[model samples]
Structure formats: C-alpha cells, structure tokens
Target: MQFTQIEYFLMVARLEHMSKAALELEISQSSLSKTIARLEDDIGVPLFDRKGKSIHLNEYGRIFYKKAKKALDDLQEAKTEIQELANIQEDSIAINVMNSKLLPKLFFDFYKKRPNVKIRQYVLPDKLAQQKLIFGDIDLMIVINPIVDQRIEWVPLFTEEIFLVVPKNHPLATKESVSLIEAKDEMFIVSETGQNFRATENHLFEKAGFTPKIAFEGEDLSIILQLVNEGKGISFIFQHSFLDTYLDNVKILKISNPVCFQTVGIAWNKNRKSSFVVNSFRDFAISFLKDSANKDFSN
Candidate 1:
C-alpha cells in the first residue's frame, strides 16, 4: 500500500473517529471513510471495528500498526541517510551518553570528523540509557558500565577504575588509595538505583558486609561531585568520569587492592539496520580508540 494509505490508517486508528481523523488530516470526512474502506478491501481484512462514531483497531490492525510504525521510521531514516550522502548535509545523530569527562573528548572528535551532521547528545543515566536504546529513542549509547540486554549490541571502548571522591580536608584524602573496608563507615553520595555505578557501589558494600550511610542519592555526576566537595559525603565514581584538571575541594583517590573497574562501551539496537554513515562513525570510533591505545602502550 501507499505511504499515504499507511499514514491515513495510523491517523484513523489513533483518533478512532472518522470526523476527528479527517479534520486532523485536513481531508473530508467522507473521503477519509472511503479511504479506510478501500484500504480494508485492499488488505483483505477488516482493520477497524465500528461502534457508532467510535472505532477500534482489530487484532490484525494492531499487529499492522506495530509493523507500520517501524516501516515509517525506517523510511524516514533512509530518506535522511540518502540526503546526507548527496551532500553530507541535513543529517543528525542522536546519542545517549552517561555523563563523564571522556564524553567531551569523544564528542568533539566525532564533531571534527563530521561538522555538517548535527549531533544530539542526551546525558542519560546508565539504566535510562539502556531503556532508551532498547525502545529506539536513542540511536546509540556510551555507557560507563555496560548493561547486558538481548536487544542491544555493545562495543567496548575502554575500561576505567573506580575512584573515591573525598574532600581534600577529609582524613581519607591524604592516602594514595583506600580499600573498601577502610571507607566502610564513610557517608556516601551515590547515584540512584538504576545506574550500574550505584549497583557496583552497593555490591561492594554488600560484599564488605556493611551499608554505607548514603547522605545523598542522585543521577547527576556533577551533583554527586558537588555533594562530595561540600563534604556532605564521599562518592565512588569511574576515573574517566573525573577530570584530572582539579576540583576545588575534592581529591580523587584510587581504590585498591581489588580495584573496582567498569568497561565503557557503545550500545545500539541489534535489530535496527545500520546506515553507511553510522557504520563509518562506529568504525572511526573503533580505529581511533585502537590507535590511541597503541600509542599509549608504545610510550
């Protein structure tokens, strides 16, 4: 069937009223009704059940609706990709990133490579990022600690060790590193339940047979850092998430001997078809990281 037919079907199915759907589509009510009838005839199934002015999509229609939405999205993505290939213009990339210092380095590098394409970045917590990726709200994600899901394909970018953020004046700040047992009683400023970081923190505490006195719970890294700076509580975060430049009051200390580490990665829906541009970006990211890692190793 034609795209217009599918559009009309979706609108009518959503509105459930011929007049309302027609008004929304800027078409005559009779024309809308006729088009629906024609579509049903063409498809050889009754798509909607009429109960006076109200209507509901039949089982076949409900199934068709799901497929139709995916088809529409694919068509739109294809059109965008085609236009982008024509002149490398008018394309946008959406990425959900777990807020971290390395994010800017990655984003700026990608932007330098593709100045024409608009990059939409969403700072999502790990759990929400995973959820969004699965639901197709985001094209891909750069998560701090990768979460496994059947719907996503994850590629490892790197691994980073977790560090404790303590105020410089705090007693633990003088030490080069601290163990879980040493910091067991310290009040913690932790990420909320959904994030993998929070999960790790909780796991460590559970392993050590202690529950930290969590003073603040949030998803924002900056906020978590700020709380630690204020001496409200100490926080555990990935080293990459903390910039080395300097914080006014907080000191980032490594945790040992069982170093807490998390793998940072990019995740995208497995079922979604990859465009050449997306593939290029992914390839570039992989190659760039490999080269960078090799350079570091050689040095």
Candidate 2:
C-alpha cells in the first residue's frame, strides 16, 4: 500500500530471493521479508510460493509485478515531464548493444558533436537487452535482428556483411571471395558456443549447408582474430571490424555464396516519452549509419 512497500515488493519479486534482493536494496533480509509479509497481508493473497529458503512469484504476483512496475514508471515519467516544462531535464540516454565492440567510434563521434549530452552504454545479449527495453530501464538498444513486439519501435540502422579472413600469403588469401562450401575443409577460428557472435555465425553456417572445421573457439574476439593472424586458421570477420581494427596482417575476403550479412538496428520502447536530446541523437545516429553503410570496407 505504501510507496516504499511497493518498491520493496517489486525488487523481491524481480530477484525471487529475499537475501539477494535485500543485498541489492542495501537492507537486511529480515526487514525485507517482514515488509513482503505485510504487503501480502494488505493485498489479501500470498504473492510468492516459498520452498525451503527459495521463493517464486505466483500467478497473482506476476500480475501485480507488471502493474506495479508500470505505475512506478508512469510516476517517473510525470516527474520528468515536470522537469522538462521548467527546462531543467537531464540530457542523457542509456543504450545497450549486443556487439558493442564496434561502437566506440560512433560514441566518440557523437560526443564530438554533442559534448553536453551524457551517455551510458552497456554490452548485453539481444534478449536481455529487449527485456530491459520493455521495462523502461534502458532508453534505447542497438541490436542485430531484434524481436518483433507491439510496444517496441525498431529502425534498421545498417547492414554489415561477414567476410572470410586469413593471414597474408595463405592459399586463399589471394582470392577476392570464397564460398562457404569451398572453405568447409579449412580450419577455422570461431566464437565459442552460446555467444551472440557465435550464434550469428552458426546460423550462416547452417544456411550454407556445412559445418566448419573449427581449429579454435574463443569467447574473446581479439584472441580469435589473433589466431587467424598467426596462420593457425582462417575465420569470418564483420565489415565493421575494419573501421577500427588493424587488419594489415590479415586478408579479408568476401563470402560470395551466402552473402552473409547482419542487419543492425535501433530499438526503443514506443510508449516511453522521449526528451529532445534523445530525439536529436536518434537523428544523428541514423545519419551516421547511413554514411558509414555506403563505405566499402573490403580494401
């Protein structure tokens, strides 16, 4: 019933553990448990199912969780609106990217144009980033192949192709392009399983009708590229990698058969109110991507 009680309940519901939630909220576990018990008593229903020391939000709890989160978000939006009216709103945006390694130049470039705007960037997987986008916790997301949702606005920013890479003087290094079938026997350096980059490569490999002979799998892209650079194996690389990466030791070849390309996009909550600064940056991003998309990174 109370504002603080609702805040506590929402946190407990999200974490699904009293101790973890208390630690996050900087309060004692006993106090958080008592607060949840009082909240359930006031609501006239048990919100969580307890087993041993663990807990799970029940059906009623899920319903309340959604409604309570929205109510809080709406209250925050109202406060922001008031600040905007007085011309005192903060100029900032929070963004989460799946492949954030390719974005330093973009952020630095934007900073040069809008030095007064504050930016917070996070590197997260596509699905988790989408969840935070829906929750209004993040203002925008830069994702590859975003999910279709009614409450989210998705705009295609650019398409970046995947190219085969090899150390100089390798057999296939002289070729301008190669088919996946032709390279099926080549020992490849690839991303580790369960990685987003790996998932993208996996899909392209599946569509190309052959599994690669992987010589090494790494979670760190720098290490994988290093392996390719050492003549240990060949690998695929995104075109955007050429923007900042030093590829003088490696030869980047186009993938002719599959023409594997990833469409990157900007995603945001359609219902969340936006500030003038956010809108300005969105426009700047679209223009930036447009210009970059036209450049050829194949050299």
Which candidate wins on lDDT? 2
Backbone atom clashes (below 3 Å) for every candidate? 0, 0
Best by TM-score: 1
- TM-score of every candidate relative to the true structure: 0.67, 0.60
* lDDT for residue 151 in candidate 1, whole number 0-100: 75
**RMSD of model 1, in Å?**
8.6
What does candidate 2 score on TM?
0.60
lDDT of 1 by residue, 164-270 (tens): 88998999989988777788788888988887778778877776667788888998878888878888989876755544344688888877745577777777888
RMSD to the true structure for each prediction, in A, is 8.6, 12.4
For model 2, what is the alpha-carbon lDDT of residue 185?
84
lDDT of 1 at 24: 98
lDDT of 2 by residue, 80-101 (tens): 7666444466578888865434
- The total of clashing pairs for model 1 equals 0
